[model samples]
Target: MMSTRLEPIQIGAPTGRLSDWVIAPMHFNGFAGLPTTRNESVKSPKFSCFGHQWRLLIYPGGDRESSDGCVALGLQNTTKESIEVETKFIIKHPHGGGDIRKGWDKVARLSPKGSAVVGDVGSARGYNNFALRSTLLDYLFDGALIVEVHMRTNKPGQQSAPFVPENPAFQNMLKDFGNEETADVKFEVGGTVESAKGRRKRAKTPTNTFYAHHYALRWNAPTLADMCKPGEVSPTTITNVRPEIFKHLLYYCYGGKIVEGDLQSDAKDIIEAADRFGIVSLKLEAEACYVDTVEVTLDNIVEIVTYADSKNLALLKEHCMDFLSSANKIEAAEKVSFDDIPSHLMKDLMVAFARREGEGSGNGDTLSSMRVSQLRKLAHEKGLSVDGSREMLIDAIKDDEEGGETES
Candidate 1:
């Protein structure tokens, strides 16, 4: 039996305005007896289109008793609210690579299945003529049938709204309670009002004291909340964190945006501080900023991966793994010291490398045992230099596998 590789297709997000339509491809395998007199349908994976989840329902045999011989397909709006959608269904021709039917386009009001009956094909008599079971079998690629559905919202003028309301009332509330006049708690960073940059100035640095309402700190940062008492007169001395980074964290707590540029150079420190203070949202934001701005290279991949592992940042670790496995594979293998990588992480990298080369087991015979022709074939497949002695070829292959450039 041949192994069927499931490759995910990349779908680009809509550019300017919200997407008017979404295109999703559904592949159905194990197509035996389908669509009998009973109402039966195969469902596609749920996808987000126009701010709502949707799926495709394909019926090989007619869905209803009236239309038993023909194929039936429908669009289902899985979301709770009623949605207006226009759908176009196209089936690939079994023989030639074109549309079997010209194309079927319909506009309807769609709601959850039980609530309202909408956006269905062949509801009247069922589409019996075009997609027969025998014809679909011929079109199957490796015993799988593929169908494409194009779905667009009927309300083209409506714009997608943000899930959270950006209200000014919360900012007003912060200002009222967070100012020095009303704030009962104080945070002093490094015994100075200014940050590291301010310390370099000729002028004397004053004590860095930020006033905040204890309630705000309690609500935003659970860890910090634990340290604070109801009416403590003495300021909380934070010796570990820099004044500027703490200011950024405070800003986020007060419903202010943390500009990406301000934290670009201090992402690691900020993320660590956020993690320590139990600021989940700020930690996530810092992680995203770090991933977006940091350059991934052979020299830094191991360090970054280790840092991510230490911080328990799953997304950053996954990003680093992806880069090391694909973009900087050869360089990482050659330059990164395996001693620095955790044992479990190294094992994961080995497994990934084997999977990329379609190797069942990572261990294998040396290049010397293989013939010159075989070595040449392997080099050609891997895009490596083939003009070399058996020993030289062996060294080159090993270096390439280890993500190192062959020596001149």
Candidate 2:
């Protein structure tokens, strides 16, 4: 079992959009209120193209020492290995003005971030001074700044993967996921603390116990490998992870068999667990599963969007928001509770809705085609009626805005 390693994944054929460049456009509304202090950045939701997840990181007030007084922009590679991409950035002008286009873009290579937490920008690469803040602010018409990224992924260079002869005994070990007889390591996941011997103590529950081989975990997960190192005790206790999630993690660690469980309910948890275990490949796999499996409906849109935003699951959030902003669904979405949306996620939604308005029905200056909830929220803020049809609500908000302008 120790010598059983699989062959390199045969890249026989390209997946979706593998042969073409992907044009991703991002719009940030209410840019003035975003943090202006240096390196304080915001990220666009994850997007998938050419079989990889990606994002655009924006440091509104620059990133590093040399980047001060400018906005920094970077393209992040979310695959298991490092990637090089041919990339370009275009700052779009509002109200039919010419776009501020530049070919001068320096993108550093993006590598796999093993066990690095979020906000660690090591997995991304782009210009430190993507745009001068002083001048860049002028492009934010309607408090919105838009960027269009033209990128095509370069084919990964051929690399050698170790091919070891398979052992039947080792292959059989993988079949027994939690078999104590076969597994050399034990783990206790998710238990409560109790007052024992006049002090609080951590104890393991029997149902929560899981078993696995040390070498398999050590080889598959760098974080778990650290635990199996010298000076570490057995029956390792992990309070943060549930037993089911741990079992799933062990399943992937032993072999590469990801159980096609209920992904819609557990996908977020799986993605999170994989990240915690330094399983970059598993994280990517779980993310792809969630992105592909989850269906966002009006009833579930708010909850799904909030989760995606909180996790920075960009592509999932983007897809849900797209479904949410469709003309037929806008009013239906208002019936759901968005009050629970985090401030940051609410901002994302607002920005998305504003963009939809700009592209669909807005005059490029005045607000139009806002969702019913948005209109009611505005009406309430301005001490007006929150009742009526969408059109009536829009009219009331419009009339109030006109009245305020006349008074001013």
State which candidate has the highest TM-score. 1
| lDDT for predicted candidate 2 compared with the true structure | 0.67
Q: For model 2, which pairs clash? A: 45-314, 46-314, 46-315
lDDT per model vs. reference: 0.66, 0.67
lDDT score at residue 141, model 2, on the 0-100 scale: 64
Which residue window of length 10 is worst by lDDT in model 1?
A: 121-130
Model 2 CA lDDT for position 61: 78
Once fitted onto the true fold, the runs of candidate 2 whose alpha carbons sit more than 4 angstroms away are 1-185, 190-205, 213-215, 227-233, 262-265, 327-333, 336-339, 343-408
Off by over 4 Å in 1: 1-167, 192-205, 327-331, 347-408
Error of 2 at 79 (Å): 52
Residue 142, model 2: Cα distance from true site in angstroms? 82
TM-scores for all candidates: the values are: 0.44, 0.36
